[model samples]
Target: MTLTFAEAGEQDIPDLTRVMTRAFDDESRTYRGLDKGGPEGYDNGDFFRQWMLGYDETTGYTILLDGEVVGGLIVWIIPGGHNHLGAIFVDPAVQDRGIGTQAWQFVERTYPGAKSWRLETPAWSLKNHAFYERKCGFTKIDETDSPDGVMFVYRKIIHPD
Candidate 1:
């Protein structure tokens, strides 16, 4: 399918929430396993909506597939450093179809002068780590954890020359 990347506006919040709910629901199932009976604590549509809408407008992009809202990435440009790719998710049904990769490449091409791109994923998500490293060209830089949880941070330097 032909996917398009566009600047997301406040009006797109609802559709974005729906897509995220569906995507994260699949992830919750993957991590929690089927024996949980029904969806556990991870299905937080309200939280996703709040987070997505809370993003600063100047640094985010939403993805549309075949003119339907599908996914997005919230990029934050740190004041004195690299760009941070805060979130990127596609509909679970569309995963492994290169939509995420294309969306990422679109971000890079759109912002040609960025010094580097950074992102963090849960340490437990091995599939995500492999995808970011092998497909998106990111390398694990460091990791951190607290009583809260652990996350692996990855970075890819983008040279303008």
Candidate 2:
């Protein structure tokens, strides 16, 4: 499947919410160690809509597949260092299909001067950790707790010339 990256605007919030809800639903379940149906609930798109709308545009990027939003990345440039990938998400159904990797590659190419790119994933998400380490070239620099109680942190340096 072909994936396309785009700069999302206010109009795309509905689709973004749909994809994020599905992706985060599973994430919340896994972090809580609960079955598909559990007390630890997940946030819907409204939550992300509010949060993302508040972010400055220069650092935010979104990806679409076949003209539909399937993923997004929120980044920020820190004063003394490289940009941080604050959040990246792919639609649950479309994950493991290289959409995320391509999106990251897009970011790297878009910001070549960045000394490093940092992001965090759930400590228990072995799949994600391995993907980042082996495929994305990220390293484990530290660990921290999620507000919901999960723990892990990782970083990767996007090579510079």
Candidate 3:
């Protein structure tokens, strides 16, 4: 039951890709009624590897459960406290157990200077919508039609007290 975040590296690409693929596939199967989904290279290590080590303006972490890679998260830390949450995916087998929430908390704590966090998700992903809006306090700022489907953009603002 121990959960941790480690700086991701090239060695983690395989595990991260596998977990990301599983999460995407689960979403497709459950929500989209499709056999598979996710953007290009979603299931491949090439995409996962890009974020694993050092990608432009991005900081990535591998979510570990009992020292095993179970998920991955990436954030684009733009200047001026305006940042973007690129992605966060956990193994479908371990979904809904607060791991994703913990990972999010980690982001906030690790970057106290962040004034806002923005991200986009597919409109059909009700599970993701709940997690970001309900659990993480993100507000839907915009919704746009994309080639894939309707896309929802969310933002969580931090007011310095």
Model 3, range 52-89, lDDT digits (tens) per residue?
Answer: 44467887899999999899998999888889998999
The C-alpha stretches of model 3 lying farther than 4 A from their native spots are 50-54
Q: Pick the lDDT winner.
A: 3
lDDT of 2 by residue, 36-132 (tens): 4211322444545545566563355668889778878777776555668767788778888888889888888877778887887766666778778
Candidate 3 Cα deviation (angstroms), residue 109: 0.6
Span of ten consecutive residues with least summed lDDT in model 2: 35-44
Better of 1 and 3 by lDDT: 3
Residue 7 alpha-carbon offset, candidate 1, angstroms: 1.0
* lDDT for position 147 in model 2: 68
lDDT of 3 at 152: 98
Instruction: Mark the regions of model 2 whose C-alpha exceeds 4 Å error after superposition.
Output: 30-42, 46-51, 159-161
| Best model number under TM-score | 3
The TM-score, computed over Cα atoms with residue i paired to residue i, of candidate 3 is 0.94
Ranking the candidates on TM-score from highest down gives: 3, 1, 2
TM-score of each: 0.82, 0.81, 0.94
